[model samples]
Target: MPERTETSPAHHGHQRSPGREQLETATTVFALLADPTRLHLLWLLAGGEADVTELASESEAARPAVSQHLAKLRLAGLVQARKDGRRMVYSLRDGHLRRLVTEALSHADHQVTGAPWHA
Candidate 1:
């Protein structure tokens, strides 16, 4: 394990607590990400904004499904959409989430390739 630095809390932050509501909200978000389609949608949005047609084509999911997934993500405050004429352009709402999706995918790649995990 990596050594804890001055910035690091000696123990898990959870030990100090973020309050039940905050933790529950986080778990709910994680539950949303547990869905493969939803996770894919997030990963795609992290790259940049795209419309439903583009996201459907790139994700290889049905257009309706992509829209539905986007709706769920949007409601969760994970993504944002803006009207671009008749099209709705979507993107990840923050850089932290972008990095989270990227790191998760990288970890997934390591698992699939039997690569050793690194900290």
Candidate 2:
């Protein structure tokens, strides 16, 4: 078996530790996620891609507010947008982000519901 190192994931796995640049980038991603509206937008996108109108309607955040939040997320590279006819559809840029948003919400659910944490 491979010996665990400081860089390993969960302190006992094989994943490498994030370097300084990666840490800064992750910090920026976390900062963007700090906003409730932005997080909601991301959570919605985790389900699948959607255009602005659909997102605004589902989130009930207003068309303009959703657009602004999407702009920030797009600029941060957490999400991507593409023109679908006349509408701009958005989606999580990668599976990693989708999983991250899903896991974050799952963690929040545990805290709010007083559920036991899983290993």
Candidate 3:
């Protein structure tokens, strides 16, 4: 894999163009949430942690399908898993992720409804 580099221009003591970082981060997070299965998985985890079987049942998706989405979320660092006896329970890694998702959704809703979240 190519070595990841910080592409954004730097400032005095902080990264410049935070909007750029927000957009990039939002894009990645949105991409992860794009799939219905993954979204459902997130919703489930929003309530609490669950294993593959639990998530599959809650999402009404096949085990492999749920596992696939979980893998992607894990790879994205959006979700973390812990072995609970024989099952691996997954949960959202960052509390900010929930806010990010909520804010993005609110923005979209506002755009469609012509009631912007920001003035």
Candidate 4:
């Protein structure tokens, strides 16, 4: 076998932690947002905090499904939930996440057509 070198491409200027872990975190976040239901939920939550029933009604998804998606989003740190009496209200955890989602969607729309967002 060839002798391992500290300057090999695999280790060249790489941090102790693998880049793949960061990529995986990003991929997980994107994957959670990829679902149409989840995207709608995020859009609604972007306005303010809402419970599962409200999210389901706004997104046209079943209550249980919306709850499940919210759970995943919470796990990813993209959203937060608080207990209000008998219901759990969810909201965006980071304001930057909201901006990122909006910018990405706008970019995707622009890519599909030549028109850009005026507002």
Residue-level lDDT of model 4, residues 2-116, one tens digit each, is 5557855345344455488878987888888888888878888878899999899988899899988998899889999899999998999977678667877777788889786
| Best model per lDDT | 2
Give candidate 4's total backbone clashes.
Answer: 0
Clashing pairs in 4: none
Candidate achieving higher lDDT, 2 or 3: 2
lDDT by residue (6-84, candidate 3, tens digit) is 6423422344446887789868988888887888788788778899999999899999999999999999999999998
lDDT of each: 0.87, 0.88, 0.81, 0.82
Every model's Cα RMSD, please?
A: 3.8, 3.4, 7.8, 8.1
Task: Give one digit per residue, the lDDT tens place, for model 2 in 43-118.
Answer: 9999999998999998888999999999999988999999988999999998878877888999999999999998
In candidate 3, list every pair of residues with a backbone clash: none
Over 1-119, each residue of candidate 1 has an lDDT whose tens digit, in order, gives 56766557445333454679987987988898999988998998888999999999999999999999999999999999999999999999988678778988999999999999887
Give the candidates in order of TM-score, highest first. Answer: 2, 1, 4, 3
Q: Point out where model 1 deviates above 4 Å.
A: 1-16
Clashes per model (N, Cα, C within 3 A): 0, 0, 0, 0
Of 1 and 4, the candidate ahead on lDDT is: 1
